[model samples]
Target chain A: MTLIQFLAIGLTILILLKTISDFKKNRINLLAFLFWTGLWSSVIIVAALPQITMPLAKISGLERGIDVVVYFAIVFIFFLLFKIIAKLEKIEYEITQIVRKNALQKQNNRPQKKI
Target chain B: MTKLIVIIPAYNEAKTIGNVIQGVKKYTDNIIVIDDGSKDNTYQTALQSGAKVYRHQINRGLGGALGTGIEAALLNDGDIIVTLDADGQHNPNEIPNLIKPIIKGKADIVIGSRFLKNQSMPFFRRLGNYFFNLMTFIFFGIYTTDSQSGMRAFNKKVAQNLKIYTNKMEVSSEIIKQVRANQFRLKETHIKAIYTPYSLAKGQGFFVGLKTLGKLLILKLTQ
Candidate 1:
């Protein structure tokens, strides 16, 4: 095998081990573990061959395989970032509600001031 | 008299919140203040001023605080909910004019319009008002004067149905958006916005206006 192919195999093996470890520790659900394992296995296949992505690139109307990977990588990273931001906003909103509820409870205990 | 409740959303208005609570007290005894995590002494001052006070652990901006205040007012059996700023920009005396139409059953929602009269409102602020007004017309296909008015009065139905998701100054315009969407009978009365250097500084800046528009648009499209 070529040096580049050997390096890809090593990297995919590392990812596979990490995914399996996470699954064993119950840090990730079965579906997530399966997804990561499948993803890394696919990478191992493509990295060893370097020709599988060509068909994908052609189907996606891209000229080069690496270009297709780059485009999809950008899109996936951006989608993940958007989801993180939305989750953060929701958490902040829930925290606001909790704080507001606690404050109201405290205020409710105090007698209404008669002016 | 109607069970009128004054809801004030204050953020870091320690210096002027007491006077606002007192001013509203002159007209009605039921007052609710939502202190949006003020680092200053706004919570104690409003509570001491005889208004029921709720505090947020962190600053939630004008929109978040207003949402909390509205919920509290509805729970407190407020027949008519009148909202005003904690800063002294809104004249509490004009509150009667705002809720008059609601009290008379002429309108379901009454809003205080600063542009209805000739006042010393700054030139850029007026221009900004027109900008958002035109945007509202384009997006919602509804035309109304002073879309960003802070002083407003509405009934329990509105309080029960109106959804507030924003956590910033955009809450003012969101109120108009939701009112139009819900098809509530809206009234515009000529009321003055007391403008001072401090009030102006507390008001939304030019960049904040743009950010509010972006947020409102996102809210419209996504949810």
Candidate 2:
């Protein structure tokens, strides 16, 4: 195989292994694992056949496979950014609620001095 | 969460919190004071006044304090929850008038609107109230005479379901949105407010209103 094929194949296999390990460790659920598996499989297919993306790139008005990959990466990063921000906000709300509940419980258990 | 529990969110209102709690006691014995990290003796004074005082480690603003107060009330089996300001701007005597609709099964939420008809309020402040009410109408599709009123009554279910995340003056608007989103009954009553020098001085200014509006708009977009 060519050097580029060897490198791409190595990286795809590494990522696929990591994804399976993450799923086994219960860090990622079945849906996320499937997503990563499908994504890396597509990457592996594209790497094995470098000429396969030409039609996709031309159909999407892009000049080259590299441009198509760059555009898709940018869109994927933005989607991940939105998801992370939303998850962060949810965590913040939960923290505030938990803190409030704990404070109230502590106050109720403690006896107060009556005037 | 069965009896009426009045939840008061106080922040740096040591001067008026004592009297406000005392006035509320005259109406009901189940009084809860959430001291939002006051720098003064607000917690001690509230404790001395015979109201259960929950102290936050740091100031969480009005919404944070109210969130704590409501959580406490719900946990203690509060059948009804009444919220009022600690600056003594709201009259504790009017708690009954506010809760009457809820007790009669006519409404699940009651708002003590100072603008059912303009009371003794400054022109700019009245304008501010109108603007907030209009915004609530546009955003939440729930119109009221005053959406910014601090004195409000909520049923136990409403208290438990209404999730408040804002930590400042924006909470007032957020409450209206929740009321609409949950399809709860909302009623407004004409309640008098004593806008004294102290209250006016400590109350939200025009810029604070703008900031609240911005926060609410962002909250809407995100949701």
Candidate 3:
């Protein structure tokens, strides 16, 4: 297979994995999926294409396959971190809303009683 | 005005619980000292110090002790709750610093950080703290200089929802993770940490940190 074909297959696999995650989490958003899929595809293409890949790799002083894999792993981990943070933020907001509403209801339900 | 209750988790600190309890008297009369199932005279010393003491009947680790202490404090009318180590490493004179942020309505929880300033700590101890702080920051984006500090203050609302299940030293990580998840306002204050040779050697070893992270990962995955 050609380098471009390998890049295409790898990018497609990453997109499929991400899509599976989004589906499992029930967070389907067309624009976000398209953006991430395109981003990863470009990254794979940029790393796999021989003509541009070697020169860029030499210029940046990064080894061929290992450096690319390392960079990809780092970026993937950061993306996962942000996704976790977003989920935590959502939960925090929901909890705060429920607590506030509960407090308000309790305050309203209080009656004037002789102490 | 928020009423404050000091929860001192004493574990065989009979030699020091008396001074610790007496030390906190000027600040607040409401204090709960959990004897943590100490085999020594911990309960007797605490009672002599004029604190309402409760016995756990068995050793429940520091986290469990703190949980029991918080519950007792709340039942005793705690509006703001502070947890202090009974080993005397924590200076009760600095109690006000721990609780001031809550009083100012700025933070729901305030943690006393030993490394927040130029406090003297052992070499290995400092290195361990730096490592854990980095791990915590990388995982949660919440950078606390001293994640293992024993002095902490929490308001009533936070105190109510503070469920600590990690019955050991790992509870420190669990505490920060919960704080981040709950989005509670956090404030760190520079406080002095008195570390004797004994206390320095008592710090968690490297394997303990790794085990704590492993437990944390398992809990996260299971949850």
- Model 2 per-residue lDDT at B197: 95
- What's the true lDDT of residue B73 in model 2? 84
RMSD of each: 3.1, 5.9, 11.0
| lDDT ranking from best candidate downward | 2, 1, 3
Evaluation by DockQ, superior candidate among 2 and 3: 2
**Candidate 2 residues A2-80, lDDT tens each?**
9988899899999999999999999999999999999999889888887888987888887887678768979999998
TM-score each candidate: 0.86, 0.73, 0.64
Ranked by TM-score from best down, the candidates are 1, 2, 3
Tell me the spans in candidate 3 whose CA falls farther than 4 Å from its real position: A1-115
Model 3: share of true interface contacts reproduced: 0.00
After superposing candidate 2, which stretches have Cα over 4 Å from the reference?
A: A1-92, A113-115
Please tell me which model should have the higher lDDT, number 1 or number 2. Answer: 2
**What local distance difference test score does each model get?**
0.84, 0.86, 0.74
lDDT of 1 by residue, B60-124 (tens): 88888888888888778888999998889889999888888988888889988888878777899
Error of 3 at B31 (Å): 1.4
Tell me the tens digit of each residue's lDDT in model 2 across B48-78.
8888888887777888889988888887789
Model 1 DockQ vs. reference: 0.39
Evaluate candidate 2 and give its CAPRI docking class based on DockQ.
acceptable
Q: Candidate 3, residues A49-86: lDDT per residue as tens digits?
A: 53555664676678775465558769999888867855
